[model samples]
Target: MRVILALLLMAGMARAGSDRPGDFDYYVMALSWSPSWCALEGDARGAAQCDPRRGHGFVLHGLWPQHETGWPAWCDSDARAPSRSEIRAMVPIMGSAGLVRYQWEKHGRCSGLAAGAYFDAARRAWTRVRRPAALRQPDRPARLAPAEVERAFLAANPGWTADMVTITCKNGHIQEARICLTKDLAPRPCGADVVRDCRARAARMPPVR
Candidate 1:
């Protein structure tokens, strides 16, 4: 009986964090504000995305695999890593090849896709959402409520509703906009854990370079 109970406990533990590939419920496509990232950590690291010439606005952060109540990360997969050329190709949209590789190892691996297909899916997900053009062209810094950001996104993307998106902040600066999507790339309502919108009355938005 003792041995049987121990085996059962081990089985439950194995299912907890979900390291298996291709075994998740949905995706959260995170779009990071390039300016905010630069202000926060990218500039210090001399990240190429922080270069003024890049003029990046919202860049693809990652497409994360989420369970109904939790998330999976760093899943074990047999897929090969993305090639240098492939990584470089994604830089215009994702800001960094390093980030591309990291996202693949972490979240993309859980998508049950090869590196190329995973990246393609991420690209498709990004293309489906219409980023607010007004926010992209801001010539000066501004403070915006988190709801205002969500409203802008909802206005730009017709099918997206309030529960489908959330705006996150870091260090008083607008951070990332996270949107929930089905495996087929259609917008969906976020899970409870994914709907934690920033409570800040106003968050700083640095202007595009």
Candidate 2:
């Protein structure tokens, strides 16, 4: 009886550990503000993103598949890292090679696609959204309310309502904009927990370098 009970417990534990890809309801496409990321990465500025010549604006951070409460990460067993070519392909959009590898290991593993296909999906999601012109040409540093920022994004991308996106900030600086998508990559409303407005009344946007 003791042996049988132990086997039952092991089976239950195995079932609890079984989270696979395609188990998510939606995805959140995160786009980082390059200048904000550069500022945040302070002495560690050697990243390609920190270089002014990169001419980066909102760069792909990652396309994270999210559950309502928590998220599934590092789901795949093979756990193969992204290749050099895969890293190179993402550099233009993702900014740095190290970030590319990290994103794959953390988020892409749970994406149900190989590294290449995962990045391809990331690119597809990146291209699907439009960056607001105001954000693109912030020649001088400016402060804008989070609602204003969301409006700019909504204006640029028709059909994306306020509930579909959220702005993230760090120390009064706009950091990233996260937009939720259906599994098929169409714009969708983010859950109440995921779409909170920035706490600050206004957030600064550093001038593009």
Candidate 3:
């Protein structure tokens, strides 16, 4: 009897471990965000892994450019950005049309309206950090460097200039940064060598007037 109980307990644990709740969401989202043939070699491509289970696709490339190193890679994994479409898809449909039925059938009530609402709000809030295509001119890659970009932004925004700049470059691409802004939340470039004043300004933006 003891051995049987132990076997049953072990089996239950294994099932729980292997059955990750969000795997379908990850894969489906990856398809949405990544290029059509992104799985060419089976390695996760670009920033897809950040939303490894499900990606917002190239739509997010401009919003959060991929850095080849550091924790920034997992920024989306924390649920910072979920595509609006992905949010709509998750509650009603999971892996595919087929998954809609499967998720409902299997778990009976795992992730329901609550999870859907949570991810949806996350998607909306992400738009603030999301860089619009108009803002990012990737075609002018040759002429643009992160530092120069910061200066230009400073000029454009007046108060919100680049306060710090940390360039995460690999394969000749500067990935992302930790920007500080003026009291009005005007953006400035900031990084490791950035000054305390910039950090202070960024840290304490004036309330919206």
Candidate 4:
């Protein structure tokens, strides 16, 4: 039931240029992963690869690259993480098959995931030529709220555990791009500014022990 979302390129930490509207096919919901879990196949673009590919959690983000055409891309955060219970809540109400169906039914009519755009072999990346109005707005990264991020994190993982979070963005199987988190959000880089923000958030959050 797990499929590696191709849109993950948006989550890449490599360097890339900017993308215009309609440049990409759509934002993607990456398979369960933290920034560090990502992996690169070869030395092609100096990509990083994660070992023991762990994706055992519910979906948490909808990352999109700043650009789709040039080099390393910037990732714009989309949907805040959804609580595991919230997604599963619909299971009984919607049925396992019906849950996914209900999701598509409620959002697919205007969703981008259903658009079926593509990543050409020559371009070696994803591009969007067709899209639904819903995808245009709802899934847009600009709409995400800080509270939503916290709430979603709380839901999916009643006790979400992450010592750190690193971010990365990629172009197909090519280029590597890194997304920079805010001052309040925990970043993955050792000396990266994210460390400061993560420490701050940790200070505010309830003690885990």
Top candidate, metric TM-score: 1
Which runs in model 1 stand beyond 4 Å of their true positions?
A: 1-17
For model 2, what is the error of residue 168's alpha carbon versus the real structure, in angstroms, after optimal superposition? 1.0
- Residue by residue across 1-209, what tens digits does model 4's lDDT show? 13345455534432343332233322322222222223232224332222123211122322332222232232232433334544454333222333333333332322222212211110111111111122222311222222333334334433332323222223221111122222222222222322122212221111101
Alpha-carbon error at 13 in model 3, in Å? 33
Candidates ranked, most accurate by lDDT first: 1, 2, 3, 4
Of the candidates numbered 1 and 3, which has the greater TM-score value?
1
Which lDDT tens digits does candidate 2 get at residues 1-209? 99999999765543342258657667889998888778777328577677878778888999997876456776764856788998999999988888899888877877777788889889999998999987885778888887888889999999888999999899888888999998789999997668897878898887888
Q: Report the lDDT of model 4 for residue 98.
A: 33
Give all candidates' CA lDDT scores: 0.91, 0.83, 0.30, 0.26
Residue pairs clashing in model 1 are none
lDDT of 2: 0.83
Instruction: Give per-residue CA lDDT, model 1, range 1-209, as digits (tens).
Output: 99999999765643455768888898999999999999999999999999999999999999998888778878888889898877987899999888998999988888888888888998999998999989987889999999999999999999778999999999999999999999998999998878999999999999999
* Model 4 residue 51 CA deviation in Å: 33
Candidate 3 residue-wise lDDT, 54-144, digit = tens: 4322232111211111112111132223345644455321223333333333331222223344334323423433333333433221424
